[model samples]
Target: MISFHFEPSSLSSTEKRDRLLKLSVVSSPILGAYFFSTGDLSSPFACPLREFTGIPCPGCGLTRSLMAIAQGHLSQSLSYHILGVFLFLFLVLALLYFSAELITGHPLKISLSGPLQRHKRLLFPLLGLFLLSYHLARLALLWQSDQLLPAILNSPLGQYF
Candidate 1:
């Protein structure tokens, strides 16, 4: 069996948290650019799971969705992939939180940790179901819409997709 394990470092909690927060801030712009870049949008990168087994991956339209959101088309972005919208919002919030922590030397603390940890058994399956359903709906919408193809193709990033 192959297994992975993570051992907490000896670094002070504050130091570790600060380092993580700083990393998040530094990577935000790069992530945003990658999300919005036209160059990567047109790449012919095939989904590994899809290629190996001829099944569409759950993340197929994510890139297009990100591109659409980056271009300021919220409705079209959601139609492309709901995950993209969620990701965009999450990233934005995370960036803001990290920035605030960095500037103020205080971290945002979530109060639901105890309940969340206790409910992991249920939460994991629910998360999986949500993701699967969301992706399938996105794929269906993509198939039904012809407008999305040309719109994506016409964009500067379309050439790279």
Candidate 2:
């Protein structure tokens, strides 16, 4: 059996890569659940933020998109969430890359923190701006179309609002 526990500081670059890959795999079931299920779990799985505030967060449709992608419905995934395809592909690639490193015993860890640290100021703000813009646009469109609030209000948790 492959041991999933490893001390990070004691890990070789290859081991660390393997650890990262395993961590990604751990989330696969959840992503699969989202991909396979039609989200009838809303009663139990609803986002508390959305349930109470009637606001859709940036990650709202992520799982459903993954489900669509799992079924080979790329366009539908994108329709559910614009960046879902990218996120899903990224997770899959990361898992595959790390798993390969673990099996090959190669230290192919890509050190990105250095450059990201160097450009933190610019990158952080840009990321924030992009997220804020996307969220606002999503909210604006939903709000203007008079859909978000009503839908939230009609859900089982509507009494809370």
**Highest TM-score scorer:** 2
Expressed as tens digits, the lDDT of each residue in 64-154 for candidate 2 is: 7777776677888787777778777777777665665565555344444566657767976887788788888888899899998797787
TM-score of 1: 0.57
TM-score of each: 0.57, 0.67
Tens-digit lDDT track for model 1 on 1-161?
22222333344578658757676775664366465565545423556654444335788666677777666778977776677787777677677656655555554454445666678689769979999887777556655776445545655455556
**What Cα-based lDDT does every candidate model obtain?**
0.62, 0.68
State the displacement of the C-alpha of residue 123, model 2, in Å, after optimal TM-score superposition. Answer: 4.2
Q: After superposition, how far is residue 39 of candidate 1 from its true place, in Å?
A: 7.4
